[model samples]
Target: MANTKQAVPDTLPLLRDRIDSIDSQIQALINERAQCAQKVAEVKLAEQGGDAVVFYRPEREAQVLRRVMERNEGPLGNEEMAKIFRQIMSSCLALEKPMRIAFLGPEGTFTQQAALKHFGKSIVSAPMAAIDEVFREVESGAANYGVVPVENSTEGVVNHTLDSFRDSRLKICGEVEVRIHHHLLISPHSNADEVTHIYSHQQSLAQCRAWLDRYWPHAERVAVSSNAEAARLAAEAGKNGRAVAAIAGEVAGEMYGLMTVSANIEDRPDNTTRFLIVGNQEVPASGKDKTSLLISAKNEPGALYHLLEAFERHGVDMTRLETRPSLMSRWGYIFYIDFVGHYQEEGCQAAIAELRDRASEVKVLGSYPVAVL
Candidate 1:
């Protein structure tokens, strides 16, 4: 047989030329996509005929990310590949209208990280002191949406988040899960031996309890409002020649210009936190969706059983269930439930209807597309 295979180039110059060509093509295609997004915004404005046009659609973005993952054929992992597309979509959406997002933060917290992960870095992030403030920002139209932590894989539910949902009219439009990795950080001027006080958010402190006991048992643990605040305090203390350190994530450490004394200090390596996106608009069904509900059962015998039986009878899959003290009635509790399927679906609607009949009050918080990236 005649030799027909072409020899692969081993020269660096040839590889560089190929990469440059690919970059040029990628840039051109990205601009083309941006133009299309602009056209979509124009169409939306013309149809709505007002400034109230919704440029960002959570369901559409979720579908796009999911489709990208499904069609990806790569040596790169699904998440890494999806992230590239995420930045592209974020840039294109910015050409339409830059999205403003509020998150629980002092700017370097995990909630802020989740907002960037969900919306992409091409967004205006406003940091609020508390979760309720994040909700209020979205409710008052100061921000297009808000991101707040709902649950931690290690610590269970964030009760304050559930309580905020009890009275807020905002809906859960999307969700993002971030793996939590706490690090012990010290200022550039400080060292491990000089560190006396370890500062972090209460939850973070608890998360790293065992690690602390083993490493710095005698050091005083001080709980602060947020990890970023802890980082700020540590940095400030360093400037003053005080021996202090902070337990925070990489973002906070880098943001405050602190050095990592120890990395991944959390007791549980697999600790992860789930955050929810809250907004004023309702999200349409993205083929894969989840719905959250707030239900207050009658204070009587078998009240909880009656409320749960409806989902079992309808064959709906329940994902999480949490209870919080009711503000309306003393000694009473309200249930927060999350289940698979959109509220618009027949099975979910039937289950919700049955729940309403059995419970004293039922509120469909929102149906949102499942996290894709």
Candidate 2:
């Protein structure tokens, strides 16, 4: 058996004192870091001479988070350690200048979750009604950056987001992946057994289709604008004596003051969604990076073959290839390609040079640091 001293760590009061000392040290160090960040802002402003000074550096933050994970030893996991540093960096950056972030929402949506994940909660979040509105918000300078869902692991790409990219000139500054956990939620006054109507976003409903099919097969599954909206509707319906439940994330449930009838009701175990960060500033190469391109290949038969060949010949890694119908011509289509390495790198540059020569048009969407967390 373990010794009582080893197991109990002596006394609670002594432990509390040690914790209090550590807390004081942590607070002092954090203030010192914030002061350094303030100096950085002053330096940048002095050099740039006005509002042209840029504050947030996604690559720098990613590097710091990666180092935090690498250097972490023990009681906490790597992600947990990184999360602590992420918030600290967020607070320090806020001391420099608080950023405004836009996302698809009425708040409490997965996109909002992603926005917070990528930029941290120190930002001022602007909830946009639609994907296009998110683009417009950032484009018009209403928000410094925007977050939108690009694809879900189970359901595939968000067509609306991809479609929005065709017209907008926003850059893909970074990426974040959010694990989706859906719950069957109801108001406190709701009778769980009496649920006759179910509400959720179409994607969320489809994600939890199998579970819903097996349990409440007869409940009318109504698709709404967003999961948060569904939660709001369920809250309203319960007060009116209607038996309604919504399939949404925990954030939505808390926001709408609803209780979870069933947690993690999704059919798949790993229902993850990837969101893209859209902004105006171009991110510099961050060692490990990915480049996105919008290519319009000629209608000729061998056009796509030539584009693919360029990447193969240069020994460049291609990660994603998505096709969208071109708005300019009826028969033509736009190809969205994502590949490893920054566009400025020699290999990527050679490959892209070859792509432009073979294709009718080529647009470099953005080359950004790969997601670190």
Candidate 3:
């Protein structure tokens, strides 16, 4: 018996066979699911009478994911299960209709991530270089919808998005809030201790200003088009082994082959950014809805107060009121407002009429379901 080795169980072949069987079953189930999705599309088309509306219902998909997570009882946690369901729903929705979503990008930005989270992995994404370009893409029918950041918990409203709405005819179809986690990334070849310059989008840099001041106080902060773009630039310059890095998402590190030297570098831990979905079509009433409008008030005395009074008398709840200087004319202002109630309701109609009467110009941007997040 002198040191003779025992035979191995050869479980690898058995496991391989089991995997192949499961893959076949999964393939069959996928085909069946796709057929069902086609039926859903047909039903939606019949109900809509060929009206151009996106077939994907994000709220419904979210409900489905919530149910799946609640029922899951496996080695995987609730978040893991929800993630899997999210992708599945994305695929099924794609079968119903593959949506083209335009987002502010060069990928890996929080905006891109939020768009993917809302639209699912099945959507075709176009990364627009500028925010205006994203609005243009949706307006021109080149994309089904556009996703752009409207506000952040830490830094307040994104003024550019508000200004764009002043001229955009696209309606707000939906909204989503994504938790923004900023990270400090450096190329693998770079020495963190020797870093002299940091780069990121201006807003992101601003969001992490306190942290940057506390840590790399002497480093130069260079702003780029986006956080992801800054990551790309840092990775490119790694060949020279310069002391350079960027602040971006952790995923960006993996995408650009960089390393996350620090995580959660934002000044606040509960930083969340709200993004709006813009399209040419209105979203169906989901019971509770919020409508956004752009009102241009005359510079006359009491013009603003009168507009606010109209909503008060109509029993409508106003969520936000922001003022922007009118670009076309001097001594004029544009008021962006968010209010409760659907545009189709009687109270909402009365409020809108009153608002128009008081304001020099009033534009109803869109009414869409309130995002629970």
Number of the top lDDT candidate: 1
Candidate 2, superposed: residue stretches over 4 Å from native: 1-9
lDDT of each: 0.91, 0.91, 0.85
For each candidate in turn, the TM-score is 0.96, 0.95, 0.85
- The C-alpha RMSD of each candidate to the native structure, in angstroms, is 3.0, 3.4, 7.1
Candidate 1, residues 1-373: lDDT per residue as tens digits? 1211335357999767766766787788789888999999999999986867888888999888888888977778888989998998898888889999999999999999999999999999899999899999999999999999999988889988999988899999999999999999989987779888999999999999999999899999999999999999999999999979999999999999999888999999999999999998899999999999999988889999988899999999999999998877887889999999999999999999999888888999999998997
Instruction: Pick out the ten consecutive residues of candidate 2 with the lowest summed lDDT.
Output: 1-10
CA RMSD (A), model 2: 3.4
Error in Å for residue 286 of model 3: 0.4
Clashes of each: 0, 0, 0
The superposed Cα distance between candidate 2 and the true structure at residue 280, in angstroms, equals: 0.7
Clashing pairs in 1: none
Clashing pairs in 3: none
lDDT of 2 by residue, 1-373 (tens): 1221243345889777766766787798889999999999999899987757889898888889988998888579999888888899988998999999999998999999998888878989899999999999999989989999998988888989888877789999999999999999999878999998999999999999899999999999999999999999999998998879999999999999999899999899999999999999889888889999999989988888899999999999999999988878898888999999999999999999999899988988899889888
Error of 3 at 284 (Å): 1.6
Model 1 RMSD in Å is 3.0
